[model samples]
Target: MNNPAPASPSPASEYGARARAWDWRRALAPTGNVGDAVFRAALFGCALLLLLIVVAMFVEIGSNARLSISRFGLPFLAGREWNPVRGEFGALPFVYGTVVSSLLALALAVPVSLGIAVFLVEQAPRALARLLAFLVELLAAIPSVVYGLWGIFVLAPFLREHVEPPLQKALGWLPFFQGTVTGIGLLTGGVILAIMVTPIVTAVVRDVLAAVPVSQREAALALGATKWETTRVVLANGAPGIAGAIILGLGRAVGETMAVTMVIGNRPEISASLFQPSYTIASVIANEFTEATGDLYLSALVELGLVLFLVTFVVNGAARLLVWSVTRGTSGVARA
Candidate 1:
């Protein structure tokens, strides 16, 4: 049917115009789906890599601690004895020191950190606030070894000469405040730990408090609230995130090695007095990792490392979960 070549359907020019229109439309549209997918996959990969690294750490520690785990059984935790030569190992003393020192550090750090945070967020002039924040965070930049050195040469002497005596004279009746006023003890270690962790606590709290919506402060003040009241209300609102920050600091205190070991006297004893020498899991590992000749001794230290790792992991994990929950629940606030 050569009926005028079937009118050639449509003209080539019309087909070209249709193609050009399609091209223009596509240019105007969002068309980077493959790029978006690649970016999303990369982010997911980073998250998964962190999780896998954590799992790998647990596996490595567990595998190394197998000998001690098999040898000690449940009594390992309760037993207080530790002798490398005798191959008698118990984690009670280390556990006690770690917990007590961390608790003490927290007790000392929290109030001070909160005060600094509040001062910066609600009270200080902007310039002054920035200056103070810089100084506060500078503490975190100091090395652990330097803190240990300062603890040994400076803080220890100050406590021994001045601070410990007053506490001993006033509160020596209590078990916790008894014993010889040695500068290098649980209390001293705790103080060192407190100094080390204060930056973390303050920095976290400052950010958390700052993340609180301006409207929250305005709302509190609108209801005839005083400045202090407004601040308190804001704090209460951010309490969960604050708690997470404190827990994160506690984790830091728990895992401190050289600074604590240098000042804690490295005695594996569960004494009631803060003045008494004590040993934490980390301190023991730092002090004895090289001297651990026997397989059991090495394994015991590795097990202590495992314990410290688990404790840190659990604390940080809980803090992250709590912070996430608080951030998710809040409105118009940055993620903690």
Candidate 2:
């Protein structure tokens, strides 16, 4: 057969040729258009608002830099001294407390939150899941002050009576528990922080776990995987997002004022013992901001606030990046 006559254009192709022949300049406007202007304005407005907020914080805190440097020096971050009466002000103790409590909260909350999320999204009946989720959300809605009161009246005493004594007995060989279980130490504060942040971590984790497509679970089941194996794979795939949830919860823990302040005992000293009471940056501010007598004191507090804000910002930003990486990895998996 003659080299199949160069495949003739179909009728649809002919119609397309005719269509391109017609002028449609009015119908399809040029690139510079109304939509572009509106989009630009909206973006600019958002950027301007964000700039204003950042500028406000900078301006507010900049006024205190001179005092912070003059009084404390660069060594403030490393030195453990924090005597306001003696005019010595090192942030080391507060930094230690803040980090310890936040990390401790993360340690305690992450597993429990993950379990709750996995159970709710994967295992529980629909009505029970909804009820439990509502309860967690309700916990978040509870005011910090309420949590503080509960910590003071209910939780603290229980820890003092039951948890602390046993923990001290068991881990007492460790330096962190070498001292008496005074019921208002780093461990106690951390436990309170864990309780306060549990709802947050659980809620975020629940959402992320739910976002895992059913296909993954079905595929695992098809491969004869056990329920635990399927769940494990889902958790492994969503590890970054779960980590982000923990970090976000930690951000909340670091900034938590009322509950930590109420139970932390606000002692501005560094000790190896977790049972030795300590003060956090947020607790220090909450406890003393009202009565802060001098300019140095007030500025120091403001500077602490700035430090906390920076810390939480970094943590949350890192968490988002981790989640983004997970999403990208998940996309890669889908493509492959």
The top-ranked prediction according to lDDT is: 1
Predicted candidate 1 versus true structure: per-residue lDDT over 49-114, tens digit per residue: 999998999999899999999999779889988877787898999999999999999999999999
TM for candidate 2 is: 0.82
Q: What is model 2's C-alpha RMSD?
A: 8.7
lDDT of 1: 0.86
Query: Whole-model Cα lDDT per candidate?
Result: 0.86, 0.80
CA RMSD, predictions in order: 9.9, 8.7
User: Candidate 1, which segments miss by more than 4 Å at Cα?
Assistant: 1-47, 328-336
Model 2 whole-model lDDT (C-alpha atoms): 0.80
